[model samples]
Target: MKGQHVTITSEWTPREGERYVLGEGPRFVDGQPLIVDILSGRLIDSDSGRTLIQIDEPLGAVAPLTGRNGWIAAAGTGIALIDPDGVEWLAKPEVSADTPMRMNDGVADPMGRFWAGSMAYDNRPGAGSLYRVGVDRTVDRVLNDLTVPNGPAFSNDGSVMYLADSARGVIFRFDVDTTLGDLGPAVEWVRVEGGSPDGMCVDENDHLWSAVWGGSRIDRYAPDGTRTASVPVPVTQPTAVLITPDKRILVTSASFGFDQPQVDDGAVFVAETTVAAAPAARYGPSN
Candidate 1:
């Protein structure tokens, strides 16, 4: 069957003087889309269209989080636990680097572990790596020598993991070991030149949906990495994507580094797709 793609337009901007300069992570929380304003360090409620919660200013830019205690977020230096009421506190890992790291794309695994990556500001190769943050706040590096690691989505059955190296324009797949929480024998799942891969999610049928940053569109790929469909956007820097419970797809864009026509262009759009999105996995409780 052929996949369907649609575009939803934005209705509101974030709080005054607020914009998602990086704008990547978007995750479903309690049937509602909860996203992070990467620049302002705010957690936004897609339904109310409000900055529902604000993390402490010291944490740096935050990423959309899904955790057992109702919320989990990434900071410029670490991760944090958030509650339904938007109360949050740092979930500092016992083992982490001091070489100026910030969490990027991440997802909660079937084992309830949060697997996230970090990258340098300039998207330099070997400047960042992937890490696993357990429910106990323990940190372990899974892979290294990565340049702008993003996406970090798992298959429907949790048997495989899909990640992207944006600068290289390649999506990688790895055998997932849930018990040991390890990624093994990684291979290039797909290599799309000319465009960079940003955020992604898996559909109910297990197909991978990736947002192409410079391409201004979202590309759907079969489990084996075949192009299934493409959904274009009006924005130049399309960054992240999320499929709602009702099977609607929402996209967030960035006006960052754009001129007047583009600055007036930042928007959050939504559209319905033929493929149903997989249910979101809640992060396991703090141990």
Candidate 2:
């Protein structure tokens, strides 16, 4: 399909309550919107502005665990399981402790394995890598040489994966072995024009929606890499994009780098849309 532009009015509404220093990872779990305050290491329920859990280090993203009580999260320098009792360390990737890196954007694939990426604190180029947590709880370094790795969003059937390297302004695609959690060669998918692509999600129509970190917009692209639509956001740093089941678009923004942040800079903003998202995947062996 050829690309077309769509308009979203100034009707974007920010969720009331607390603003985050770095708001990211907007997802729907059991029909409720959930987001993360990355810098503060908080997982929050977006609808009520309630803090679900708080970790000591940065919490990038989380996925509900199948047949389990809590969540599987990409936090700090590794992956961990967060439950009502407390946080249990899973596997920490072998990044040098002195280098100072943290986990970034991540999501559970359709086959229930979790994938996340890491980046250095100083934004050092070629100092980041992508990791995947298998169903057996083993961590594998999937890709290397990333700077600001933001996403590893998967397609509905888990046959295709899209990953974004924000500092490099590119998103790459990969073929996946869903049954075994193996990936094929990475192919350059999209080279973002105006802003760096941060977090992203795939919709029911097999279209990709990405949050433009410095461009103040959310971009929708067709499966063939054609830019289809753009949703203008009021905030400059739209960190992540989530499409709800009821066809509402949710965007998370960050206030971490601002000297004097705007009123809605760190808030979760929503707009009614006509496109719905694919069912979110959980992490675990049972699935």
Candidate 3:
């Protein structure tokens, strides 16, 4: 059931062609909110509607996350750690530089492994894969031959992992082996008939809150994949969702493919939500 609207955070709009503000990653790390502007390489503060740092490099996903002093960013075909000095590539992607493939959405597991999904720039089928970065800094291609792989949110206990193939309009849950950082066979969790599921976040009660791209709304799902709640946003392309440390529900939107993008097309919003924050932020390596 849809609920009443709540107070929104400071409103901000994308400059231009800047879709999916949280397309890469948006999560609170150590009490600070971090958001990645995937196409522009803008590291936004998510508070003052300001850009804290901007790099020329384009990234598929940025884990508004860090192990200690640096961030884990999926650039081109590899994952890098960005800090005060510079960037360091921790793993090299398997595909060649010429491939039309690029990363999409990603997150860290409670065990501290970074998981990222990739897709073709032209939306070609079976041209993407999901990669896992171990704590030892090894990159492993776990899932292959996919299209538009989105969320990788985990259960509270880290026993289950929720993954999505948006082009199919479905999300899957997998049994996870936290010790080995491996994913078991996936079972259908939810099938969205209205809009493709994009990025997502897990709440305190083992429910999934996902952004419905092109649906102009966000939906909440139980562990068994049943719709429990929904919320409407001001944009048509709400790419991702997140909950800040202070308990405000924040959503990220995009402006891509819109003929004449409106003022709210690329805006990030705050809405009413009853769920608290997740058990803890995704794990990462120590300093």
Task: Point out the worst 10-residue segment of candidate 1 by lDDT.
Answer: 58-67
Q: Name the lDDT value of residue 139 in candidate 3.
A: 84
The lDDT of each candidate is: 0.69, 0.89, 0.73
Q: How does model 1 fare in lDDT?
A: 0.69
Report the candidate with higher lDDT, 1 versus 3.
Answer: 3
lDDT per residue (tens digit) for residues 53-83 in model 1: 6765322223334433455665665566666
TM per model?
Answer: 0.84, 0.95, 0.88
Lowest summed lDDT across 10 adjacent residues in model 3 is found at 3-12
TM-score of 1: 0.84
Q: lDDT tens digits, residues 1-287, model 3?
A: 34222223343334333344344366776666666777777777665557765666666566544446566777666677777888888876734735666677778787778888888888788788889888777888899878888878888777899988889898989999979987899898899977889888887777788999989888888787878777767788888888655766878887777779877777767654445665234437645
Query: Which consecutive 10 residues in model 2 have the weakest lDDT in total?
Result: 1-10
lDDT per residue (tens digit) for residues 1-287 in model 2:
12443334347999998888999998899889899999899999999998999889899999999987799999999999999999888888844655889999899998989999998999899989989999889999989999999878888889999999999999999999988888899899999988999999998888899999999998998888988888788999999999888788899999988999999989999887766886568999873
Question: Which candidate should be chosen as best, given TM-score against the real structure?
Answer: 2
Clash pairs, candidate 2, are: none
